[model samples]
Target: MTEVFDAIVMYQRDHKEKDLMVKMLTRQAGKRMFYVRYGKSKRYQFAAEMQPLSMSTFEGVINTTGLSFINDVKATRPTSFLMTDIVLNAYMTYIMGLIDAAFVDNQPITKWYDLVAEAVTKMEKGLDPQGIANYFEVQLLPVFGIQPTWGQCVICGRRDLPLDFSEKLNGTLCQQHWDTDPYRMHIDNRAVRILSKLAEIDLHLLGSLNLQDKTKQEMARLMDKLYDDQVGIHLRAKSFIQQLTGWQNRMINRQSSAKEDES
Candidate 1:
């Protein structure tokens, strides 16, 4: 029996000479892998539509053999623009990869599916990609039952203290908690306010918020560290960003200069 699913292509890998294995996040079946025969052939080169982040409809058969064979695919929304810009492409790949890793097979995540679909649509429409990514992280974490408490301390439930994002504690830690721990991430007041606003803003308004470059960098760092600790992996796109922005080079140069000054 064949099943039809609405899905977004999460990844694709070469299987054999002309075949490919496709991983898709489906609305009905959840994350699934499908085998495509002769996917590289000239006649069906359009099947390359199975690239990461492309939305499509897939028809395939599920059997007990552990791999499903996809009979046909129709592209519903090709986010080709995401591929046109290098920075956006890197960010999208990282975000999609993180989501793909976070989800388990056969789990129903209709809300996550909607979130990703909405995010992609916004990206295609020229939304600020970085802001969208940060907003998504704030919203996505809670869906996985790992949402961080931003307005108050997770331990004392104190709402009057300033917000400090600590990966060690997994949420905002008050001054009292910080004095005790002494190792929490000291998030500034502006960062806290921005995070709180992001949590409340709708997806459509993501691009409207104008954050300074420094604030965006700080929020990105905090979110990346938080997710890295929770998810047990680092995003490669972050390293790519560091390289593109010359941040790593500057850090290295500063270290060298400090050593020279000591000498």
Candidate 2:
């Protein structure tokens, strides 16, 4: 049967000469794949939206067994910020990869679809990329049956300000609990507060907040380990983003040094 759905392109891969398989997260349906008649080339009108984090409307046909083929697609939204800014692009990649890792094929995760669409839209509108990403990361937990308890220590139920996080406990610990394990991910009250705020803040208001670099760094470190240790799933997108950012930073540094020498 022919079907039309609102979807965001999450992943894409090229097959032989003129065929590309595209994966999408539909708003009302589960994850789905559709085949583009022509390869993802410059000539393809919908080529730009075939990349990760692009939102589009999909028109296709599904067979009896639920496999679908794409007839046509039109871009609904452009994640222009992600493509224009390297750091933002990396963040978008991480978001896409994280979702891909978290969900199973053909599983309806409309919540995630909405979450990504909103985040990317905000990012496109000049919202802080890291802030947008952190917000999504915290929200992603519950969809996968992993809601974090941040206000109190998950281990002993201590209500005092948390000092560190325990992967075993899947949350933070008080000072007393933290000191015993030297290898625990050390966290200050600020980090915890950031996490709390990130979890609760509305996407539309994300642009209003000014996040400190320290808090962003801390959250990045904490959440990376949390996802790996607690969820046992390491998102490759994080590493890719880090590498891209690192390389981009080095280029900027080198350019600055050359400019200084010229001066």
RMSD of 2: 3.5
Worst 10 residues of 1 by lDDT: 204-213
- Runs of candidate 1 exceeding 4 Å displacement: 62-65, 142-145, 153-162, 174-181, 199-207, 247-263
- Give one digit per residue, the lDDT tens place, for model 2 in 1-263: 67788887778888788879887778767677767768556698777767776777877774435556766775466666667787887788788777887788777787778778887777767777777777778877876678877767766778655557666666777877786566777765787777877877766566555667667778778887767666677667787866775786689899999999999
lDDT tens digits by residue: candidate 1, 1-263? 98777888778999889988888777776777878888767787556577777787767785544777777765467677877888788777767776776778767676667777888887777776777778777776775568677767778989787777777667777777887567877767577667767777777556665677677777877887777677556667766865765764588789999999999
Candidate 2 — which residues are off by over 4 angstroms? 41-43, 62-66, 142-147, 155-162, 180-182, 200-207, 245-263
Clashing pairs in 1: none
